[model samples]
Target: MTSQNKSVPAFGYEIIRDYALSTILGKHADDVLYWVGKDIARKFPCSDIQLIISFFEDAGWGTLSIEKEMKDGYIFQLTSDPDLLNIKNRKFRMEAGFIAEQIQCFKGCLTECYDEKKEKQSVVQFTVKWDTKEKIG
Candidate 1:
């Protein structure tokens, strides 16, 4: 996917994404955010991978790229500014859920996504796997 040059203020974004949501949601923040991501995906669906990547950039999430393609899944890498990565107790579950639902909608299958934070690399890796047998109707 092509990259976009647009940017958003990290400070304000984090205040809502990391601080406010986490403070209000507390222990359930991750789970709630994941579902919220899915809901957002439903509200704004992307039919192709490029559109999905563009959506991420437009949402000020980060730059998303495909790291690898598997038979039934895909691995995506998300990267942003170093300062964003350095934030304490940051979470990417919302992005993960958005990916899962987006792929499910695109492929018409049951899909799931999980994210792994690589602090050393300052990146988040998302794994999206779909069950071909379980078609979504």
Candidate 2:
């Protein structure tokens, strides 16, 4: 069998990983060489980058990529439907932010919540920062 059939196609951990990483790269659509903390994050009890991407893809998060750097961490990006920005429950944001803070240099996540009026769909975002080493990493 080919490598494609050698493993499970999806897992929850991957979903979490993809979500966190993607949130980082989502900071700037034009930013390059995006890097994020993987080592410490790897132990978070869920999926890794690729699997996470798959999970998000299943949930309709669109395509994703992980740009890497050995010492600086990794960069995870996701391109998805603009209208589906759901942080409907503020609790989710709190939980995600808390998770990010626990990682190594948790660079925080940027969420583009669309503002309803203005003739165009404009998104407003927030960044929450922390150091994983200083917390649970």
Candidate 3:
């Protein structure tokens, strides 16, 4: 398929995301998408948190904002534009997994990510944590 404009509309992309991906992946959508995100992070490694935040925006994932940074981990929140938020048709596990892998690779330790979706508030929060004592070699 070729487009004269060379840019697909956001609605078109969402259609593929909502229908194509779900249809293809079916029951394993969540798990597979998460792995795919991790794979993407591996291929395009981010050198710093700034790059990670930019990656999210550039990829049309959403706006990533750091809420807090703690000794062992960090908390981030993702929010879409008001229009997109009203649509309520997003799958963010992919983002969470991507972040988990990135943090794990960067810190050289075992890492985990937890996502909380606040539909009412139109926000998705991701908590990424790594054990400093546990290193990955």
Which number leads on TM-score?
A: 1
lDDT (tens digit, per residue) of candidate 3 on 41-96: 99989877888999998787789989999999999998988565433666777888
Q: What are the lDDT scores of the predictions, listed in order?
A: 0.89, 0.35, 0.84
Deviation from native of the Cα of residue 18 in model 1, angstroms: 0.9
How much is the lDDT of residue 131 in candidate 2?
34
Worst 10 residues of 1 by lDDT: 1-10
Model 1 Cα displacement at 9 (Å)?
3.5
Clashes of 2: 14
* Candidate 2 C-alpha lDDT tens digits along 63-108: 4445343342443434444434332311123223322323323333
Candidate 2 residue-wise lDDT at 119? 18
Who wins the lDDT comparison? 1
| Candidate with more favorable, higher TM-score: 1 or 2 | 1
- Better by TM-score, candidate 3 or 2: 3
TM-score of 3: 0.88
